[model samples]
Target: MDQERARLLASVLAPGVSEYVVLLMEGDPASKARPRFGGGRTYKTAADTAAETATGWALRRSFRQPWTGNVGLGCVFFRPNRQRIDTDNLVKHVCDAGNGIAWVDDAQITAEFGVVELDVEHPRTLIVVTRHVSSLDRSDLVGTMPRPRRTR
Candidate 1:
């Protein structure tokens, strides 16, 4: 994003949001591969197991913020080793892990955006959760209004 665009968006939306971050173990992409089974049952790979474990550990370390209202989620995945991974595959694993603690449910997340980058030195996924502008409480809404409504 350009500086001017970022500045404009921030100016319009920053004040209404409060955010928090979770640091995730880098490069543990949840395995999407599933071998054929007799009954169509699927199992998790070792990598998937490690990823799920890491997700739980990371969530526990982070504060348990039960924001029932809508959330604005931003995730930055930093891969430690370059092994040609699909960026799209990373979202669900992280978001599902964040379900209860980060927000009421992943469905409550109204705005989601992110980037995938290489952090060879210190690889990690940074998940940021912010209160959505549209989800502010009625009291907060009144306080932020430009002027009081005039009516009998």
Candidate 2:
């Protein structure tokens, strides 16, 4: 991440109220879990580890502030050890881990931005979670409304 962008993020992320956490996970970081039809879920080990890691980090830093309002979020995963991993699954793992610990719930995070890149030197997963505000632009809403035609 660029220094300027980090500075900008720091400005918005007020400590005690809102903040960000940079988690550096060794080796290839695990992705989100998927449930099966037979009342089962895959990657139980991975899921448990992620939850524990996230919660532990949150506890250590006292990131237990549960925000009632809509949250803004951005995450960047520097996955150097993994060859294939979708950003969606990775984000899911992050958001799920952050639930209750970082904020009230993942649903409260209305705004989200995520990026994944390879870092051969680091070979780790870097998660940057920040609070953000949702954009109020209603362009889609305007497009949905019926426009008036001039009959003159």
Best by lDDT, which number? 2
C-alpha lDDT (0 to 100) for residue 87 of candidate 2: 86
RMSD of each: 11.2, 13.3
For candidate 1, write residues 1-152 as lDDT tens digits: 22343333333333455354435455544533333455678666676666756775677566444456656666667777787766656766766666555555667666666567776877666566566666533232222223322334
In every candidate, how many clashes are there?
0, 1
Error of 2 at 84 (Å): 1.6
* lDDT of all predictions: 0.56, 0.57
Clashing residue pairs in candidate 2, if any? 72-132
Which ten contiguous residues of candidate 2 have the minimum total lDDT? 137-146
Q: Which 10-residue span in candidate 1 carries the lowest summed lDDT?
A: 140-149
Identify the leading candidate in terms of TM-score: 1
lDDT of 2 by residue, 25-122 (tens): 56655577565344464445655575657544653364534444556565566776557778888777767776656655677666666678777776
